[model samples]
Every structure is written in C-alpha cells, then in structure tokens.
Target: MTLPDPGKSYAQKRDALEHYFDRTAADAWRALTSDEKVSKIRATVRAGRDDMRAAILATLGDDLSGAQLLDAGCGTGALAVAAAERGAAVTAIDVSPTMIEIARERTAMAVPAGATAGPGEIAFSAGDMSAAPDGPFTHVVAMDSLIHYELPDIIEALSAWAPRVTGSIVFTIAPGTPMLMAMHAVGGLFPRGDRAPAIAPVPPARLLKAIAATPALKDFTPGRTLRVSRGFYKSQLMELVKR
Candidate 1:
C-alpha cells in the first residue's frame, strides 16, 4: 500500500502531533520545568511554542477583560486557553480538524471541576485563518504559522482579516536574521523529508507597507522585533481602527 503524502495533508500532521501530545503531555510539561533549556529554546529560532504566546500577550498590554479574542492557527489551543484564562472570550481556529479536536480536549482537561469562574469560554473550530468569518475581535493573534505562506500571501491574508479586528493584530514571523539565514541554507542543503512551506522572511517595513495599502485599515504601526533564540524573529504588532 502506498503511504500517505504528508506535505499536502494537514490532517496527517495534526494526527501525528495529537498522538504525540496524548502520549506525552505529562512528559512535555515536566520537560518544560528545566529553566536553562527553556531559556536556550527562547533564544533560538525554534523557541518553545508557549514562549511565543507569552511574548505575544506581553506585547498586547493589560486591559484585556471581557475582550473578544481570536487565536488564529491555534495549535493544541495553547494561546486560546491562555487568552480564555485571562478572561477574554476566545475563538480558536486551525486548518486541521484533528488539531481543533485536540485543542478542545486540551481545553477541557485544563478546566477544573466545580469551579464557578476561571477563564472565559473558548470555542474551537477548523477554518482557514486567512479567510476567517467576520467577528469584531478586540485582539487577533497569529504565531509561527505565517512562515508557511509567502510574504505577499501573508500580507493579503492579514489585509483581509485586519478589518475584523477592532483593537490590535499581533503576529510573529521568522526574521531574515543572519543566524536564521544560515539555518535555512543548511536545511536547504540537507533537504528534510518533504519540506514544509516557508517563505522568505517578511521584513517589518514590508509588512507596514502592506497594512498601509489596505483600504479598510488605519493607524498602522510596527512593534518590536522579538529575538527567538539565535535568529531574530520579528513580530509586527499592528493596531487598526475600522474605517
């Protein structure tokens, strides 16, 4: 029998990862306790996924109470759960059904029984982030997922989604830093299994330009460049008001 093509099937990636999480969430949680290793991971391009979410939240500032949040490309519902924990009503969406399933399961596991109040409610679904349904969210977050699309595509996607946000849109992109370039070059030479889609790093300036060009968005601003390990993975935080 022919094996499945992993590259085209997001479901395959989701299934494999869900199984990994089911078998190892406890071990993964334990492994996260090593502060030295966590620090190293935070410094490199391959930063731990949760670290990216924390950084994004830090950038978002306080005053998130009762705000509507969207966790775009929410894998396993980490940021969604975090936002909900912060008392923001959250809707988490991913392209893979299996991923959404795992996210729901994880969210349920995190909530304590008989607790009257904790985090806000989290609704998980499978959908394309680039063309998500209309919801006037106070904040929209996309992390690590933009690397899969080219810069123009990323800009187009962001432009389409920007108007839906009433407050801010925060996202991280793999910067074209020297260390990251070198890593890319080495990876290109070795050719890993079936390469995942990753476009050239979208500079903060280019992202700004795209935001400016979009008709529905205003008040475009660039935020800090976050150093994720050896590579400088820049995250441009854009605040847009509907026009």
Candidate 2:
C-alpha cells in the first residue's frame, strides 16, 4: 500500500479529487446529496452538511439583494440555488463536469413560478474555486471544498482570494483530531481502486495563526464559527470578513 505523501502539492491533490468525484465516486456522491435513502453513515454526513450549509448562509443573513457571490466548489448547487432565491447573482463552480451538469439540471428545476429571473440567476460551470469571475465579489462561499488540503495551501488560497472579496469568505475544514489522523492512516491501506482522496484534518489554532500572518488576509478577520459533529461526519464551519 502507498503511504501518505506529505509532499503532495495542492495541484496534485486537486487532480486526485477531480478524478475521484468525476469518475470513481460520482454515483455515490450524487446519492448522498439527494433526498433519497442513504446508509446510516451517509445520513449523518448529510445532516452534518445541511447544518453547515445553514450556518454559513445564516452568517450572511437573509435578503442578499444585489450581492455578487461566488459559490466556489459547488457540488450539486444546493447552496447556490438557495442564495439565488434570496436575490444574489451566484457564480457556482466545481471541478467535476458531472457535478456541474447535475447542478445545472437542479437549478433548472428550481425556478419558482413567474419570478423575476435576471437579477438572482445562477451561472454554473465546471472549474476550480480559483476560476471565480473577476471580482469585487461581495461574498464567497466554499463549504466543504477545502477539507482536502493542508493548512499552508489553504492559507495561500485564502490570501490570494481575500483581496478580491469585498464582504466575506466562508468555508469548512476537518478538525485535526487523533481519531481522524487514525482514519487518514487507515485510508492509505485500502486498495487504490475506488478509494476517496485523503482528508486533511487541521487544527483550528494552527489554521487561525497562519491566516493572521498571511499578508493578503491582513485586511480581513475571522468571524463567527460553527462546528458540526455527527456520526461519520465532522466539520468546522468558519467565516472570514473584511475588517
């Protein structure tokens, strides 16, 4: 079995994720995000994700009129659809072409009857989080997408994106607990086929310290936080806002 490669760069991890989600686990992911029945473990995961989504959206409050938002790493576009319903123009993107197509279909079915469609519309595409349109973006929401990268890489990404965002950037991370570290180790022993990319569990203090030291994020500050821990589903939801 291949051991954990600490030297794996961000691009390599991203390519792995693109392959896993777009090809290997595409069907499993689609099922998990749907209302259809799932296993007990995936059910907990779905619930935890739902809680995180609500927490992130709540931080922005309701009535997002005139907001230019980027739903970076949008999966099936659930949050994107919700934001659009609240009158925000959302640029929703993800690395998986299959997920993008699913998001587009979901959005098409989500149109409310006789509603004004121009201002709050959603543009869905297949690309990385960095593919976000030229901004002054009022808001950027990156849900569970960043959980696969190391703290340093995460810091670099936040630094690059912070200057362009006028309002806030919200995202999630897997906490670096001993149990998760064990899980990471055990994941390495699995056969190469049909295995998900390793999850990078990060400690909060370490992450926060790095964020504080990043030059580009100097103009921003950490905001409200929510931690959701359910069976087989653990995540830390965090917000970063302009100071």
Candidate 3:
C-alpha cells in the first residue's frame, strides 16, 4: 500500500475520516458509552485494542507522572483517558468528530469528583496526526490507526510529531505477514467478517524503513507482538526516539 501525501493539511485528512465515521458516529458513540451490557459488547469487539494499549503503556516503563502525551487517532479517547488517569496531560486527536465527542463525554464521566488533580488533563479534538499541531511532548502515541495509510504517510505523520517529542513515541500497527495478508483477503471477500480496519498487521520492516527515512528519527526498536482475536492477525508494537 502507498502512503498518502504528508503535505495534505491536518484538516483535510480529518475531513476524510470524519466522512467515513459519519455513517456510524451515533452508534459508535453509543457503544463507547453505553450501559453495562452494551459497553461489554463494545469491549468484546474492541478487545484487541484494549490489550494493545496496555502493552504500549507497559513498554513505556512505570514512570508516567507529569508527562505530556499526544494520542493520535484516539478513538473514543481510550488511550488518552487512560493516560490522564495515570497522571499524564494528554491531548487526544482524531479525524472523526463523533469519536471526539464521545471521547470527551467519556473523559468527563471518568474523572473523579474532589480528587486532587495533577498537571494531567484529557483534551479531545478533531484533528489529524498526519499534520498535528506542534508540541514538545513527553510521549507521542498512535495505536492501531497508522495502518489505514501506507508506510510513507505513516512515516511523515509520525516524523512530524517525533521532532517535537522530548521523550519517546510508542506506536502499534498490524503486520503484513502471510497470515495477516490472508486475513485481509478474506475480509475483502467477506465484508461481514469479524476483522476490522487497521487490524491486519503490516510488515515490521516497512515500518522500520519509514522511520529510517526520516533523519530526525532514530532508535527504532521493536516491542512485543501480540495476536489480537478481532483481526486474527498478530500486531507489532514499536518504540522510537527522536535523534
């Protein structure tokens, strides 16, 4: 797959994603913040995502206090809100307006009353990470979202944010192994398949090359590889530091 141009403005890319999510925006929101039964169903559908986020945070080490984080493509604000709970100031952005709205609502509901707050805050926005706002963040994350675009686009998007990071970037993508390719083929053949978008893993080498192409990025290291049931594909996580 070829990556989209990095030159496109964040707003433009966001508009495209918003258009796609418009059809199911309301349903997505409802599922995210639904009652116990509905939320459980949603969780089952997104089980892999929950696992991936947990793994990413684990790779980041235990000390997350007072860190500023940028969560790109923060669907329903899962990772963003979790980070805030851990005492990190988080700015979560997504291309889908509905997703952002749902995430904001969830964030509000999750915060405890009369709790001593730190520098942590969960802020949601409708923006694209491909061209995110400038930041000097402690950590930048894009989980299960970069696979939508090709390698070049992923590189450009992550690179733009990498330079502004004083700490590290933790990202996850579906690998393009034989199993993953076969799964994608099946999904294409049968749209009703349980697998969802960005779930089919891409090749780790491709991701590494993308990072290498960006002179501003280095220390590309592979993290854990986890098999997610939804996509039936093994997801690879990686961490990179700006050189």
Q: How many clashing residue pairs appear in each of the predictions shown?
A: 5, 0, 7
Best model per TM-score: 2
Candidate 3: tens digits of C-alpha lDDT, residues 1-243: 121243454444445556655443446545544454433335554565667778887866566787878888887877777788777877677787777767767666333422323456776667666566566788888886775555656677776886678878888766655566555445332223323333334577766766676675764444444544554434667777644
Q: Identify the leading candidate in terms of lDDT.
A: 2
- Model 1 bad stretches (over 4 Å): 1-48, 109-119, 177-194, 223-225, 230-243
Question: Superposing every Cα of model 1 onto the true structure, what RMSD results?
Answer: 6.6
Per-candidate TM equals 0.67, 0.89, 0.75
How displaced is residue 108 in candidate 2, in Å? 1.8
Stretches of model 3 off by over 4 angstroms after superposition = 1-15, 25-44, 109-118, 178-201, 218-234
Pitting candidate 1 against candidate 2, the one with the higher lDDT is 2
True-structure lDDT of candidate 2: 0.78
Instruction: Return the candidate ranking by TM-score, descending.
Output: 2, 3, 1
User: How many Å off is the CA of 170 in candidate 1?
Assistant: 0.7
Candidate 2 residue-wise lDDT at 35 = 92
**What C-alpha lDDT, on a 0 to 100 scale, does residue 187 get in candidate 3?**
35
What value does the lDDT take at residue 136 in candidate 3? 72
Q: Give candidate 3's error at residue 231 in angstroms.
A: 5.2
